[model samples]
Target: MNYQTISITLLILCLPQSEANDEAIRLGLKQVELSKDLNGWKPVTQSKQIRYGEWTTNAPIGQVGTGGGWGNWGTSVVWEDYKTVTSNEFERASLNNGENGLRIQSIEPFVPSNATKYYQEELGSFIISPRIDLSTTTQDSLFFQYKSNTKMNLEIWISKDQDSYWGIWEENPNRFRNHISATVAENDFTQIKINLHDLLIEMGQIFCDNERHDAVINPETNEVYIAFVAYDNAERRLGSDPKMIEIKSIWTSSYYSDGQLQPAPIDPVISFDHKCSSVTISGRVGETYELQTSSDLDDWKTSYSFTLETYFETYPISDFQNTTMRTMFFRLKHKP
Candidate 1:
């Protein structure tokens, strides 16, 4: 390895933009998979034996009685079948590791498109995980994979209460609203590993009749109930279509506090993707790398390179010859 002081900022500005660019993909991201052993969790069903109670939706959109629909949670009656067959312009989603995931879907065929009047949809699923004796373990962060094309609407909550029940705003330490619809990126199979110790508290004010249903974040660990929801109002007249979501392999474990997502000493991993007419090279932060392409993998020639200065995860990869004429293979190697 060559040891020399290099100005990362100046190098980025001086580097010419190339049609075929390379990036560093983050490593150590592990998606928890489910097994036959119940994975130490009891799948709660829609039976009286379960402690889950009546489910309701968010606040109405425009006039009263306009948009208010309550959602029910059940282990037996959920999980919509997702397929990858002859499909068109719609975005597609799949399980992260295996065919085990929870799907929250609704076939609302009649979503009136009106710009002047704001529109909202009924969205919520209250799920209580089987008794997890975290009594002995220290949780670092929560991890899961999610994807959808439901007009980009989905949210999730974790409650401290071991038993499933409804509570008002008065319950502060009981609920922790971690992820929401608007915050989730519309990627196909995005993996999220949230560090609980460093996790910031996010909350919102919704309603249950006259009573207020709000989100509260707590620092202290507690046995809880996780709720997956897809409730948000349309800011404008959205394309009238079905709204849905699929969340798979929700798990909690000790997270590795490596600075991959941050701007620090990190390894670069490359992910080549074809978007639009060109390719996209995605990578993690840190380190200078060289990306080369050649008809034969041996005589590597054409290349454009850059060190990920900031945390931008994507750069357009372009200007490669058509595969019909000559097939080009790309590679990203760390340069000393």
Candidate 2:
């Protein structure tokens, strides 16, 4: 309750404040974290080597040849007797759910210049929505796997709204975005990681494609949406052949921090009063160190550089400078 007691208490509080600020600065420079496990993220479309809707649509359509039967012009089959050749080709196949109301189409391949046949439809399209979260402590990372029987290109869209009205993410227009054209190995699941910071830097606007792009940060409400489209243009040796693509998985994970600052696999030991001089530099192997000297703590100068060797080896300070009688403050920036 007296002045001495009050002064001591204030000093203790001030000490913690300085330490906290220092820790913040250290963490702010670099931060990275990896997910412990990846699961639960949903995929819009997941198929195997089968062409998009080929197994059910094109195959059945091919089975039922162009409807025409033996008949004479003069004595043609009666209109009433003619059975309506119903085709259940596409009906049996699974179609896109249209959650985001995004439209997908299959385009026929353009025939060679010499060929009389017009372009034949062979490719299929679909959309995928990757889960993402934007928060101070929680960061989102996206991973997905894709495989194709034939070479194909994947296009992605990111939006703040479900409707196609507002265009938030695009590749060709030179708008802020990031896309990688990966040549898929035959039937292989390609894993990809989408870092939150990288996405924001690339996309000038956050959740621009969503209706509430600007509101993503509001505590009351905010939403971000991402979609993907795939196009295949494999040549068909025979007419009515089917092409296929399969998306294996789509996943997202959260970590303790901003998803940066990886922890070291091994523990490190600490030592103090390391003597460094003009002839020698004292430092431990596999560690970051700073040689600081000060007549007063207010002003300090770094005299020698510290570097770790390949293997754990003792470094002598005799090579850098001669230790003077005065005390010097030397510290190591032990980054974990």
lDDT of 1 by residue, 1-336 (tens): 999997665443555322110110122222334433333333322211111222344344442442444333222322222211111111123444335566544433332332123223333333434422222233435556567563545444455454334332111123343431112433365555444433422321222222222222233333344444443222222355455566664555322233324435545555543422223333444566777777776888636677753222333344444456367777767766
On a 0 to 100 scale, what is the lDDT of residue 158 in model 1? 52
Write down the lDDT that model 2 would get: 0.35
Candidate 1: residue pairs that collide = 19-318, 24-283, 24-284, 25-269, 25-283, 25-284, 154-181
For candidate 1, the TM-score is 0.33
Q: Tell me the number of clashing residue pairs for each predicted model.
A: 7, 35
Highest lDDT: give the candidate number.
1
The parts of candidate 2 lying over 4 Å away from their true place are: 1-115, 120-124, 130-132, 136-138, 149-151, 164-187, 205-221, 234-240, 253-336
Error of 2 at 190 (Å): 2.0
TM-score for each model: 0.33, 0.32
Q: Root-mean-square deviation of each candidate, in angstroms?
A: 27.9, 25.4
Candidate 2 per-residue lDDT, tens place, 1-336, comes to 655544444443422111112222332312111122112222343222322111111223224333553322232222211111111111111213211111222233333333322332334344434323333323344444444444455555554345542333322334433533223322344544444445543343333333223322211012345555555556533353545444433443332232444335433322322321111222333465555556657676666545543112223344334367265554434332
